[model samples]
Target: MAITSANQLELLQTAEAVAREKMIDPGLVVEAMEESLARAAKSRYGAEMDIRVSIDRKTGKATFTRVRTVVDEEEIENYQAEMTVEQAKQYLEAPEIGDTFVEEIPPVELGRIAAQSAKQVILQKVREAERDRQYEEFKDKAGTIINGLVKREEYGNVIVDIGRGEAVLRRNEKIGRESYRPNDRIRVFIKDVRRETRGPQIFLSRTAPEFMAELFKMEVPEIYDGIIEIKAVARDPGSRAKIAVISYDNSIDPVGACVGMRGSRVQAVVNELQGEKIDIIPWNEDQPTFLVNALQPAEVTKVVLDDEAGKIEVVVPEEQLSLAIGRRGQNVRLASQLTNLDIDIMTEAEESARRQKEFEARTALFQEALDIDEFFAQLLVSEGFANLEEVAYVEIDELLVIDGVDEGTANELQTRAREYLEAAAKAALDAARALGAEDSLIAFEGLTAQMVEALAKDDVKTLEDFATCADWELAGGWTTVDGQRVKDDGVLEPFGVTLEEAQDMVMTARVVLGWVDPEELVAQSEEEAEEGAEEGASEAEA
Candidate 1:
């Protein structure tokens, strides 16, 4: 192949054709051609010579050049490409080190091997440009839905031809054993776009919860218009799904809009999901109320929520137990996911029995600690007294309100309760000391004697050890393992220490030990408060 007048224009024509076919910039193809031609020219000229090629974008004219750089006497390594400053004076009036001298050269007539090598170079560059173009086009399309045609199936994975690129729908991402043949049109959610060495990988999914949300958004005009918002979605893939929605407009019912007139809208989404049943629930700011709505078709007798633990207990009628829990606990599982809380569902009868057991336990505790008779202990338990501390420190009027309890009786009960608590505290402190607990830890505020004993048993016997503990380590927390939340038992958790209280106690210890500056802590807190206030003001203004 020669860069003659006849073939000079052909170079530009071929570059534009390749660029158009690859959907990449024409300048990139031209640059690739220039590089390939330069490589061939180097083969014709000395390999050490710096040969360069340039193509005129407008005139389609090819220009070839030979370049040599002037270097210091000791730096001249390439005899054909580099010359010493003194030797370069023959080619220039004055040539400083690092100065390049360029001379026009005739374009090389590429041999069969050279032409083949140049072709491979151009192809490699074009493929790279194509991959970059594809990546840039689809990166932002992630988290969206796109229509594609199935190309083939490798193992269980299906490859789809999306207009300019091919995406893979992994086996796990398919809904309920969905099988597609070649040319089958499929709707999929672009779950992710990743740029790899080979090319951009567009992962498609039909089982994602967001897939259902996007389907609903496409089907529901109110959701698309932002009048009704999809707050949360939980899906069991092709089995069942729960969607929580809220409506900003009072006149518009979010559930009704999602369900559509005569189930037209929701039916469309259901059909696309291969008959997955959907429960549209109205979103509520209160978690319990929202959970009640989420557990539909079952009557809830009571809902007990432990906000600090992110757990909720739902008591349902015995007849509705199976329905609330669903088949194989699917209903409760989806509800838990929708509400972002751990749910423990029980029958009304079970809840009542548990409550009675708690009452009896509290009554027994009062009888033993206060040295009272069964009847007197029962009376205390019935009046909302759970422990000796409450009975000892409660207002005299609160104890007086109990039946047949006078001022003198209340005084005696307080005295007995306080005496029992002091004895228990003394015993716990003695045990902690026996286990090598230090006085520095014992005198620390906030921690009970029993907490110190618990810490001592766990080998935390000093203030420094206590300060080294993380809040979660001291107050317990939930861990996610294999998609299930597991409970991590904390040392002070049994002592009723909350996570926030544990954090404050640890920070207090650090400050007392001079490990942290109190003034800096105060300044950081104030700065955080100001940032929060500014955010609140901006949101309110918006």
Candidate 2:
């Protein structure tokens, strides 16, 4: 093959054209071309030689050069990359050991195979530059809504062309009822932009709750103006959705503003979502109030919240129960998602029945544990005494406040409560000792007599056993059995020991038995070192 000025100009022009078509920087394309030329030059100049190629931006002229570094005679290991001091002196007036030398070489004319190789190199570099450009363009657009054309469908995923690049709307992220044909325009949320080995993957989603929120933002001026803010959103794609909004301005009605006149604003979003029903509810700082608003169109009779368990029991009218818990529990499910709470919906009748059962059970417990008659137990239960601990710990003044309980009767009740608890504790301790519970285990600060008995029954009776107990064994946790998570009955369950209390008991046992965990010891040493360093700095400042 032969090369002239026209051939060099054509090569530079091809790089510029490819860069413009790929939407990458022209300078990068030229650099890639130079690298390809240098690679081809290596076949003729010897692979070990340090050959480099440069192309003029304006003239499109190509230049090739070889580079060598001057080194001491003893250090001249490679004749290609290093030149001895004696050889360097021939090329320079006074060459030092560290000086570099460059020699210009005539540009090589590519053969058929080398030209194909250079083309492949240029194509690879162009693809990389295009990927980098796509990443930079879409990385900042994550979590925002983007409009695109449906280019094609592969398997269950839709490929969308978003003007500058293409994105994939995966099967899981598409609305159930939504179907698209080629060239059909659609709006989707940019869920993520990830750079993998293949290229930048732009993941699109139509079913995300944020997609609905973004639609509302486009339709409602109040949300865009910052007067009303969306607090939370829950969506059952193509079926139902719920949004909780709060207004910073006291005068603005967030729900009304979102609904718009004749429901125009919300209807626009509904049409975009393929007729998904949306319920706009006002957000409240009070959790119960928010829950009540979330489960709308159904009147709530009562709400019982267990904060520690992160659950809420909502009692509605018997007739409203089905309404509060919509078809397949959709209403309650969406409400739970919106409020970040576990909601259990029940009828008022059910709640009443449950309360009565609890009252009877508590009354029977008092009758058996305190040796009291049914009448006395009923009186105690009516006075809101759920357990013997309340009777034993309450002030005498509090007992006097209950009807039919004079000071004398209160005193006798308190005495019986204390005596019953003491006897129970003594019985548990004797049983634990009989079952081989170590005295050290019984002496642990957080372990109750009941806990000791439970551990003794489980054969975890020694101090070593207690020290070796895993956190999950002491507190309730899930264990994998038959490829499923099964709940393990913790030793402390019967004693109503919290996870923190169980942890403290285990740590106490470990410390008493002089069992040092290496990980714990390392962490302790690091903390001590940090504290010492801070104290030294403080003393110096003083």
Candidate 3:
């Protein structure tokens, strides 16, 4: 094959045809042709020479040229491609060191091997361009719903043709017992799009909670119009699910809108999910109120929430306990997910027994610590005094409010409580010192003697050690191992140190030790506050 006038126009035609077939830019194909021609030209001409080729976009005329650069006499490396500034006078009137001298050259004749090599180069370039096109088209389509046809099954994964590209749906992402064959129509959520060496990978999912939300958005006009919003979603795949929705418009009932005229809207989503039963609940700002709705069909007698711990306890009648817990604890688990809380559901009787047990335990603590009679301990517990610290530091008037207690008795009680607490603190301080704890740690503000002892037991005996500790290390945290939450016990966790408090304490220690700049900390906090305000504004607008 040769670059003759007859085949010149064919190059442009071929580029356009390939571009149309691959849905890529024709300019990319033309550039690929130019590169392939240049590579073949290099093979025919001296390999050391810089042979270049360009194809005219309109005329399709292939022009070949050999380019050489003018370099300093002492800096010349490639003799065929570079020349000294003084030796470059033949190509220019006044050649500079970095000037390029170009001369026209005839196109190379492509033999069988050279033609095959050129074809491979063009194919490789076209493939790269196709991958780039696919990535650009699908990257922003993530977190959306798309319909596709199942192409084939690879191992346990199903490959689907998603219009312009193919996506893989891992088996675990499929609804329970959902099977697909070749050419089966499937709707999937675009979970993610990633660029890799092979090409762009589009991950599809059918079991994602977002998939259900998207389905509702598509089927319900109120949701699509922003009159109602899906606040949260929790799915047990094809078995059961719960969705929380809120209405911005006062007249529009979010639950009624999602449930449709005759359960049509929700049924559409349920049909697509392989008959997954969905419980739609109204969203509320109060977590306990929201959780009560989330548990649905089961009457809750009482709700106790621990905001800091992100946990909730729901008390239901004994008959409703089984329904609230559902089959294998699925109901409560879904409720927990919907509310973003750890839920502990108990029968009314169980809650009563637990309360009684706790009351007994507190009474015993007051009895032993204050050296008071069982009646006095029970009275103290009944008066909301759980520990000696409360009994010791509370106002004398509060103790006077209790029946059969005067000012003298209140003073005596406070005296006993103070003596016991001081004795305990001294013993803990002595124990910490015996374990090699320094005064720097013991004297640190915010840490009690028991906390210092705990830190000493954990081998943290200095202010420096405390400063180097991570907040989670001091406040305790949950770690996910093999999909299970494992408790990480912190030395100060039992002392009721929250993560934020631990962070503040550690940073304070660092500041006291002169290890951190107070000014930088202030600047960082201001920057974070500005960022958070900006994010909140953007979310509100959205």
Best candidate, TM-score: 3
Model 1: weakest 10-residue lDDT segment is 478-487
RMSD of candidate 1 to the true fold? 3.5
RMSD of each: 3.5, 6.2, 2.0
- Candidate 2 stretches with Cα past 4 Å from truth are 1-4, 70-78, 83-99, 404-412, 422-542
The order by descending TM-score is: 3, 1, 2
Candidate 1's displacement at residue 281, Å, is 0.8
Expressed as tens digits, the lDDT of each residue in 443-469 for candidate 3 is 999999999999999999999999999
Candidate 1, lDDT over the whole model: 0.94
By lDDT, the better pick of 1 and 2 is 1
Q: 30, model 2: CA deviation in Å?
A: 0.8
Please give each candidate's TM-score: 0.88, 0.83, 0.95
Candidate 2, backbone clash total: 0
lDDT by candidate, in order shown: 0.94, 0.88, 0.93
CA lDDT, candidate 2, residue 214: 94
lDDT of 1 at 511: 99
